[model samples]
Target chain A: MSALITCSHVDFGYENHDAVVDLSMEVEEGDYFCVVGVNGSGKSTLVKGLLGLLKPTAGTITVAEELKRTGIGYLPQQTRSQRDFPATVCEVVLSGALSRRGSRPFYSSAEKRMATSAMEKLGIQSLQNHCYRELSGGQQQRVLIARALCAARKMLILDEPITGLDPWAIQDFYGLIRHLNREEGVAIFMVTHDVANVVSQADKILHLQQKALFYGTPSEYEKSPQGRKFLGGGDLWE
Target chain B: MGVIMEMLSYPFLVRAFVGGILISICAALLGVSLVLKRYSMIGDGLSHVSFGALSVAVAAGWAPLFVSMPVVVLAAFFLLRITENGKVKSDAAIAMISASALATGIVATSLTTGMTTDVSSYMFGSILAMSPRDVKLSAMLSAVVLGLFVFCYNKIFAVTFDESFARAAGVNVSFYNILIAVLTAVTIVLGMRMMGAMLISSLIIFPTLTSMRVFKSFRGVVLSSGIVAAVCFCIGMTASYRFSTPAGASVVLVNLAAFSGFWAAEKGIQRKNKGERRL
Candidate 1:
């Protein structure tokens, strides 16, 4: 498969210090990639860099032309305001088509269909008219995933997607993501600290601590020192 | 009926109603995004900046709107920069700028205009203050604000809901944010002539909060807030005419009443739902 994104010695930082240094990685189409790191370990910085929200200070990070045009589907962590925001599921889901709408003032019929199909795929079509704030944790994640799908058909980048979810909800979320990645051929790039649970599902793993400590298949990651230390020790690095 | 006809008989009152209702609708439309984005205080800050600009215009013998419009718009942009840079907390920045502007306006007014009724009218707002020229200008600018809000409704909703996701989706998040700020600045400047600097922010905050108490969707809240604002403005103006009260204060009181009523009704519905679940 072709590489959807390639980062060559990328450095992301503020003025004084670099948050992510000399990071080299590649995300292939249909790859289920997991980036595991402790707090402030530059996982979010890397996500921002890949999403083009922040420019890399050092080397080049190239995105495939098609991926660049469609844009990476992004599921950012929920903010305090979003928890109480007054938006219907349909409204939130349809907003994902904003990039495709371009200069158009309203969504085209095709865009609306994309949103509807996204909701149906996530089994949220029934909840389309419901208030977003009233949904449970799993339902909310499903709505967000549907939104991400509307933005890009190729790849999704979720930052700490399972945070604040119950154990059952977490498993359901993983199942949904796995179905999207494996069954639908949609590439998954997930950043999380829940390495113990997510590592089993992820095809490839990148362990980061301001740099790449490990990058390989999950089996290779399990064998590596960094992954063993992180996964073996319960909440030690977290 | 007689009171309504008598109020409509006066030309100044008619202009006030036309300008006030249009401004109210514009404020409510923009207020949804602002209140959701936690930038509700922007209206208040920009109005203070407008007050300063008006005082400076008075000192320089320039038309108030002509001078205040550009100054308030610049202040809005400056406020956006300060908030985005994260060098200072947004609330602190707004408070500092607004307080300084208010002080500067007070000093400038004392030094030149000497507490004139024109200045007081801008501070407290008077129904008689809506001149034909002011009403015409307010109507034209309100149209622009409403048009832009409708044209960019989806983008505004996306940006307000999630800035990072919107940016990731190639939605030009910063551009839309700046657009929100500029539109809010214009709304504050236009409403200040009728709602006063001290109370104009209420026009941007109250209706949305009231609508949110009952409405569960963004579109619902936005539409409801517009209706709430227009109704409150009409009731407030009627009260002001009968009671000889300040127009700005009267409208604010009416909004406060609506907010309380909505809050109570929401609580009642929640209680009823819980009781039904218990059964």
Candidate 2:
């Protein structure tokens, strides 16, 4: 498979110091990639760099032409203001089509269909008219995933997707993500702290601590010293 | 009926109603996004900046709206920059700008205008302040604000809901944010002649809060906020006419009442739901 995103010796940082240094990674098409790191380990910075939100200080991070046209479906962490925001599920889901609509004042019929099918795929069709703030945490996450699906069908980049979820919800979320990645062949790039749980599902892993300590298949990651140290010792940090 | 006829017979009163209702609608439409973004105090801040600009205009013998419009717009952009920089908290930045502007306005007025009724009308607001020229200007600007809000409704909703996601989706978040600020600046400057700097922000805040107490959707809240604001302005204007009260204060009191009523009704509904669940 062709690489969807290729980064070569990428460095990202603020004025004072570099947050990510000399990072090299590739997200191949249909790849289920998990990036694991402790807090302040530059996972977020790398995610921002990959998504083109932040410019790399050095080196090139090239996105595939097709992926650039479709855009990467991005699911950012929820903020405090979003919890009580008064928006219908349908409205929230439809907003995912904003980039695609591009200069259009309203969502086109096709965009509407995209949102509708996304909701149906996520089994949130019944909740489309409900208030977003009134939904449970799992339902809210499902709505967001549906939104991400509307943005792009090729790849999804999620940041800390399962935070604040119950154990059951976390498993359910993983199941949904797995179905999308494996069954639908949608590439998954998730930045998460649940390394122990995700290590079992992820095809490839990138262990980071300001730099890529290890990058390979999950099995190789398990064998690598950095992964063993992180999974065994750093698991407690979370 | 007689009071209504008497109030309508005066051309100035007619102008006030036309200008006031349009400005109310503009404020309410922009208010929904502002309230959701936690930038409700932005209206208050911009109005203070407008007050400062007005004082400077009065001191310099320039037309108030002409002077305040550009100054307030610049202040709005400056405020957005300070908040986005992450060095100071949003509320603290607003508070700092608001207090400094108000002080500058007060000093400027005292040093030159000496708190003249003309300046005080801009501070406390008067129905008589809506001159024919002001009404015409307010109407034209209100139309622009309403048009832009409708045209950019979806983008505004996306930006307010999630800035990061919007940016990721290739929406220009900063551009939309600046659009919101500029629209708000224009609405505040237009409404300030009738609502006053002190109470103009109430026009931007109360209707949204009241609508949110009952409405569960962004569109519903936005529509309801406009209706609520317009209706309240009419009621307040009539009451001000009959009671010889300040127009701005009267309008604010009406909004406060509406907010209280909605809050109580929401509580009642919640209680009823809980009781039904118990059964």
Candidate 3:
């Protein structure tokens, strides 16, 4: 399979502050890549770079280029926003598919169908008419995931998707990710603080510390010195 | 009673009523988005800034509408840029603008001799003085805003809900944020004739507060708020005519009543639910 995204010697920052430097990595099609790092280690920065939200100060980046046509899906961390945004679950999900269409015309039924299907796949069809702000954390995450899916992307980038979820919800979320990876062939690049579970679920682990520390399979990561040191010298997940 | 009947039959009154409804519709829709974006205070701040623009426009002997539009629009753009950079919290920035604008407006009015003569009209509106031109201008402004809202609804929804998520999803959040601010400026600029400076914020806020208590969906909140605002505008217009009350104050009072009534009803429902669960 063709590589979906490639980041080469990328340096990124905000004004005078440097977040990430000399980072190079490639995400292959159908890869479930988990990026684990301590807080403020530029994990979110890497995700932003991958999504083209941040332009690198140096080096080159290449993405699938389908983003203009099929669009890229993104699920961000749970944000505590106003509870009355005046949108339904369906409307929110419909926004995901909006990237593929022009803003001048109304949404077609096909777009609505696509949004509905995406919500159904995430088991959030019952929330179609409900207010987005009223949903629980887990439900909101699912709705957001569904929204992302509506964009018809070959890849999904999630920033700390399971951070605020319950244990059960986290497990279910992982299961959904696995399903999306295996069935839809959508490449997954997730930034997570869940160090323990990353080893079992992620096909590859990219550890960041102002740079790319590790980029390899989970087994390779386990044998690496930095992974062993960071993973506490043993299998923390086990 | 005779004046009320005569006012109703007059073409200008019809224009005021229609213009009021149109303006309220746009305000109600934009209010939900503004509240959701957590920048409701921007409404108050920007309207105050428009007061400065109004004073300056009057002083320059230009049509206040034309002068205020460009000024307020520029101010809104400046505010959006400042807040979007994350250099300052939105509330703090709005407060800064509000204070400076209010002070400037007071000074500008003092400098302009005729400004003080009818200063009270600008504060609470002189709906009775509205001409057909004001009504047509308001209608056009309302239509443009509503059109923009519909055109950008999807991206706006994404940005309003989770801006970072929208950004990651390839939505230009800054552009959309600016769009929202500009829309808000337009609403404020048009609403000056109906709500005036002192009460404009109420027109943007009360409907959202009232409907948020009763509606669960975002769309529901927007639609319900629009309905509430339209109803209030109609009722207030009628009351103003019958009771010889101030139009702006009457509409604001009606909206406040609706907001408080909804607040009470929601509390009653919550209590009833708790009682049932305890039983």
Candidate 1 colliding pairs, count: 0
**A165-217: candidate 2 lDDT, tens digit per residue:** 89999999999999999888899999999989888999889988998989899
lDDT of candidate 1 over A1-238, digit per residue (tens)? 9999999999999999889999999999999999998999999999998888899999999899989777888999987788889999999999999888888899899999999999999999999999999999899999999999998889999999999999999999999999999988999999998999877999889988899989999888887778878888434454
Judged by lDDT relative to the true structure, which candidate is superior, 1 or 2? Answer: 2
DockQ of 3: 0.55
Model 2 regions more than 4 Å off? A233-238, B275-279
DockQ-based ranking, best first?
2, 1, 3
Model 3 segments more than 4 A misplaced: A13-18, A65-69, A82-86, A232-238, B1-4, B10-12, B59-62, B111-117, B264-279
How much lDDT does candidate 3 score?
0.81
Across A38-123, the per-residue lDDT of candidate 3 in tens digits comes to 99999888777777778999988887665445666888776666343546888888878766665544688998999999998888
lDDT (Cα, tens digit) per residue for candidate 1, span B74-155: 9999988877677448888899999999889888888886878878887888787677887787788778877776888888
Candidate 3, clashing residue pairs? A86-B218, A86-B219, A87-B218, A87-B219
**lDDT winner among the candidates?**
2
Instruction: Provide fnat values for all models in the order shown.
Output: 0.94, 0.90, 0.69
CA lDDT, candidate 2, residue A50: 81
